[model samples]
Target chain A: MFAEGPSVFSRFIVCLVLSFLLIVIDQRQQRLESVRATLAVVLYPIHLVVDFPTTLVRATAEKFSSRRELRAANERLRAENLELRFRMQRYQTLERENERLRALLDTSVMVGQKVLAGELLAVETTPSAHEIIINQGVRSGVFPGQPILDAEGIMGQTVHVNPFSSTAMLITDPRHALSVAVNRSGVRAIAVGTGSMAQLDLNFIPNNADIAEGDLVVSSGMDGVFPAGYPVGVIEVIEFEPTAPFARIKLRPHADLAHAREVLFVWPQTPEQDTPAAVPATEAPAP
Target chain B: MSLRNLRGTLLIGLSILIAFALTVLPLPAWAQAWRPAWVALVLMYWSMAVPERVGVITAWFIGVLLDVLVGTTLGQHALGLAVIACLTVIYHKRLRVFSQLQQGSICAGMLLLYVTLLRIVDRFAGVPVPSVSYLTVVTSALLWPWLFIILRDVRRKGGVR
Candidate 1:
């Protein structure tokens, strides 16, 4: 027990006002970013501590994995690698032909986009919150609104960046909306997050539109956030109402959206790279 | 500060760190929202036990750190936690004399208040927090008694007072 202080109420009131000021300041400006980054610096070690048990479990599991499992995995990877290499040859020829055609048409050709690998940190804020923290941050050239993807498909974009890490809001967040086009019909639709890991909704599609239940939806890149041609999800369900203006369309995302450990941060094309090329340079030897 | 007081502060700081660890602990998706407001619980316990040392200002600071950790706007948790600490301190005297069930009820009320403030701030920030996000209040109230006992034992063993 401690002595009662007369300053308790005063201290509490001051704290309340200060907190309100902080909230308003944070909402309006970037002034508090340094403060947040500094606090994140302090909290990073705690993240490591919280992440330890999972790391330990994964390490032990890796250590004791049977040789047969390893051999099977290696064999499967070898076959997959060969298959990819086989397809890549055809892709290269098509790319060269497309470039030649584009050169004739005076259309700008975009080069390769760079991707950085990052691992999800151990702690999640809450189930209700769709934000996730990853190990990449300002130090790794991570920026706010940078696109994030898993190996399978587009995940989401970064919302906040600290000195050592960043926070990303997943595509399943209720506030998230993505512009997507149906692969089968090429009819564009807006996919809105339903705040669930299992589903998203194409909220504005007309009942009589060209969309189908099984059509694969890919990012149209109209939003300028996600890259073009990345698979977003597959249309899972469609319900039509004669009186209603729009059909209720559901989607199952291509990315796991849950339990994604490794993510790729894509660096989108810069203005210089996207600008139409000058006269053709010397061509490299054929692969 | 005296050496004993320094040690006591360090002990309290260690418990806060542990609470932070629990607050962000990775649970299954179904169980994630049920994490019993660990940081808030620890802040409540300390402010109730030693109001002079861990009161409104400390709670607010911890809230700021938690916001950075959890990736919310700054001061969302700060205002909620400051109010919680304020309530605990205001009623600590009568609360200590009450039965455990009665104290638990008061804690539930405080948890509700904190969650309401959190939701208000969240809504103001345009986050689409659902009505069901109050699950933490239900879970925090249920776990308060056990957490109280554990922290009390730690305080006594460490000679914090």
Candidate 2:
């Protein structure tokens, strides 16, 4: 008498089974890459359609220009440009000194990595997940595990790469851990996400670790994911727990990741392959 | 889909678009921890309001899409979505009579529950548990009343659903 309609429990069971299958396939295999890529391509037009209203409004606003406001903006920009030029001269001198120091120390001279600009396409929709989608992806030379940076400093690493878009797992994601060094002391520690966007927990630090508030944390370049010497965070608070062996240290990220309008993807360069060592003639006699 | 039925389809599609847009909006790094779950929230609302139209399978499909979109373990979001959809289906009759504010509160709780489930799944998968952002779920719940009102208004104005 129920008209043979699918029961909610049955439907849920079906959904759970199907969703689990999809999940297993997606996680264990690379089979869904093509499907994801195709979906991204097909979805591009929809994005364009969705963004049209905002673009139209912006275009309309651009049409109604006021001369006074333009003049004010122009003057402001001119002043900022003059200030930047002065600072640039100082930076040039510092760069020369830095180069000389690097040469003397016999260390590889650090050069800025080439960056591809990207726009935020989406934030993590799951409350507990710390991630964002950017406009750049595999198509734009972006790859998974590449580090993302904002104007201030390190933002995150690319976790998922689509054809036209990539998902950046933010430093605040509980799953994220970075090998970082204290700039002042050169002591290395792993910074893990506390699930607080504002703070990170420095794990595995000894109770007597020589760290204090305001110490700058930068990438140690040990992981090969993030570049060395980029600002990651600043020590915000430290709580010493007598019962726990590790110090409960917290830090604030240098980058304003949540509100970042533009981000840069630092593409990784391929490392030189090591040559296989030749077998000693003495040991090769049996062969 | 027929032209007459197409309107409803478009409305639901637009809601998904809204979900996507909301998901992508730039927020502060500190706020990232507390950002509300968007796609699931939209799907939950729609599935409950129009269970005949949107089903558990559909919710699961959307969750998978979100998983692909967000780059999380594929089954995690799908499982969470299925759970929420089941809840929505079970409570839809009672939920339909609640005020927007009351419904929003429920939505917020459901979203929080979903997030907790996601975290549990993530932990089982060896991902670290994110700090308490239950506030985000609460805030998302707070947004439900307004979203419900606005969406209802949009539906009435568009005559699409």
Candidate 3:
């Protein structure tokens, strides 16, 4: 018979046996970080080579765009710039008035968190998992569990931290659940991703919950990672099954996760360098 | 090993690097939903086209790397990928005879198997069963043919055998 000998089957069986041993060892969280780090270093050069082709095509396309298209884009931008400047003037006045009002009340406003920027390196496109790798890593002052955000809104959280790179779990991943609240009513619920990037589901809310299809869900700041009131998603549907107690609510994330090339890592607390001018000065005391 | 064998090993290593790079590409949101399983596709290609060169151990090692990169349960992908590699080798002969389309279809099935196996492991780790749309095996299966042709062409032109 063609399959008479131990053949490829026997070899495969042996391989499987070896793999099981490796899996067992790996699962116990053995000291493999050094090996992984070294491998990543070796891999860095190869990554550059593979990424070259795509970058080349993108650059060439940008270079060759027609001047007509560029002019049209510039005209649209100028119009938008004028509108934004008008709004900014109103915002500046409101901000100054609010700050003065706050001073009178002895209340302090939260300083904007300083952001460390990172570029996207890779995204896990496989259906089995949802994750993205950022160019920044632990060495770049990144930490596991830190929240990642783009200009639009919250994207995900850092799950794995290596010396050279960190992997961020996307909000669309099945394992991801954000504690969010309806922007209008402040009613809280958990929003879980449905695998597909376009949608998510809100849970732990009653059937009669005052949530509608257009309602916005923002971070409640209960998780201690994302700051409160950041946009998360807008409810798309609220299906109330008569028999089921919980409302089946679907949502669309406001963040442009797919096209976002750069992101900001939000540490739970401000870094020592970004702490208030008084906090650091108080510690040194003219030493 | 002979120089020829060493060259083959180098190609395999380089291919893994390529696979890792593909995993890191910046895909648009809509495209991400349809993105091919590059790591599994490339690993399956190498493991089949060169069984003597790449095997289940190699698959498991890469699987662990993916687990780290994807940030899932530690051994989850290692087990799934290793098993898929074993299956690929066990059926390599029949696979070799099949047309590119058929081979890709099978690869897609194997990728689906990989995801399913991963979910089972994730469930055991106390992660709730994800959304109902977690079954994305068919899309990967459909992508199998295209991936197979592209990678096979690379191997053939690179003179891997």
Candidate 4:
């Protein structure tokens, strides 16, 4: 026995205007961010509930793993740990030497960054956006613009942070770009995401630049977002178009963007606060 | 109010929740492009079935929820779904009487409109629109018949007049 107060068309127009206002507010101003964040807290439980089934399946699979498989995995991990320890020893010596050299040159020593490990909760379901939600968020000291890395290299940056989770835009997202340098020749360039998971495009590199097909690309840290010297990607293709002024260079990202389950949130060292004083007396003579 | 009506509303709410979960379920890389717009389909179903109960305002609210869940620009889905709800309310009688196949075609058209609107919003927001996203409309349209039948059964069993 219920009839409408307003006609469907009138309601549609009202709602349409309201939605337009929302879109404009969300896009042009950051005013809606607090609302979104508050709503995200409410939405988090739904995510956890939706993910419960997958977590159950994984747990069951782990429970059913064979003894032989477990032993083999343990052995492999132990060997890997030994190898990492050996490499770490060499790295420590090199780090000390580099510090001494920096002191001699009257520059600050590189500050080590702190990292928070985060597990990927979900990948964005939209085919257009390459983003992932990680379990670390504002409560975990994650902030927007924090650089995310996998074991291999820089993966992306956090775009939004809720209380318990943050959304990270992958380096392969078309809107994302980072300043990078050729690890071999130190030629600076900007690598932009191509909207494809497999490739990133280097923008405006001259054809004469000493970029090889397999040169490593590392973050230049010029943008002040990503820390310096982390591997970003590797050059996969370099096409010289006779008509085009710039070379078309594509890169395969070093981090496994599609399949990475865990990522590192880097707390970059603030230069002014963390930089070691440039004292000449601290310099040790090179052997 | 009445227990029967409450049951009907609960059924509708449950169906929407299931649809949202399906929308977020992980698909293999190759099949990701073909994901059906589960939430849109559910919204269309309810709006068509019970315009008074599930109208443009309800569609707008659900659309915003979907937007948050999918992490898209806010109100993008609200705009699309509001239009769809309006159209469905206007043509609910005709759409109900049409053959299943004809209704499926109409569903495809609505989904295409939604996709196109979303793509335009994405362009303005500076997110890259993937060509494969168009495939979702086709997949959603193709799945309409089964979704329609299942939802209709639930409506009938719940006595949701």
> Which one is best on TM-score?
1
| Cα distance off (Å), candidate 4, residue B74 | 0.6
lDDT, candidates in the order shown: 0.84, 0.74, 0.71, 0.83
**Which run of 10 residues does model 3 chain A get worst, by summed lDDT?**
A278-287
Each candidate structure's TM-score, on Cα atoms with residue i matched to residue i, is 0.92, 0.70, 0.69, 0.91
Candidate 1, residue A142: lDDT: 94
lDDT of 4 by residue, A36-90 (tens): 7777887777677777777788889999999999999999999999999999999
Per-residue C-alpha lDDT of model 1 across residues A19-48, encoded as one tens digit per residue: 989989998777998888888888999988
Error of 2 at B73 (Å): 3.2
Query: What would the per-residue lDDT of candidate 3 be over residues A1-287, giving only the tens digit for each residue?
Result: 23423664565466556645545555455465555556555555544565567667877988999999889999999999999999999978887888789789876554456678998763442434567777788788887678889988899887666777777878877778777899988899888876677888788889887878899899886665666678999999888998998988898999997778789998654554322232110000010
Docking band of candidate 1: medium
TM-score of B-chain for each predicted structure, in order: 0.95, 0.90, 0.84, 0.95
List, residue by residue over B2-83, the lDDT tens digit for candidate 1. Answer: 8878888999999999988888888887787677888899999998888778899999999999888887778999899999
lDDT of 1 at B111: 91
Q: Write the per-residue lDDT of candidate 4 for residues B1-161, one digit (tens) a residue.
A: 59888998899988988888787777787888899988889989998888778889899988888777778888988898998998898888889999889999999999899889888877776565542388898899999999999999999988876
In order, what are the TM-scores of chain A for the candidates? 0.89, 0.78, 0.75, 0.90
- Docking tier of model 2: it is acceptable
lDDT of 2 at A167: 70
The DockQ figures for the candidates are: 0.57, 0.33, 0.28, 0.47
Task: Kindly indicate the candidate among 1 and 2 with the higher TM-score.
Answer: 1
Instruction: Report fnat in order of the candidates.
Output: 0.72, 0.55, 0.28, 0.57
Clashes of each: 0, 7, 1, 0
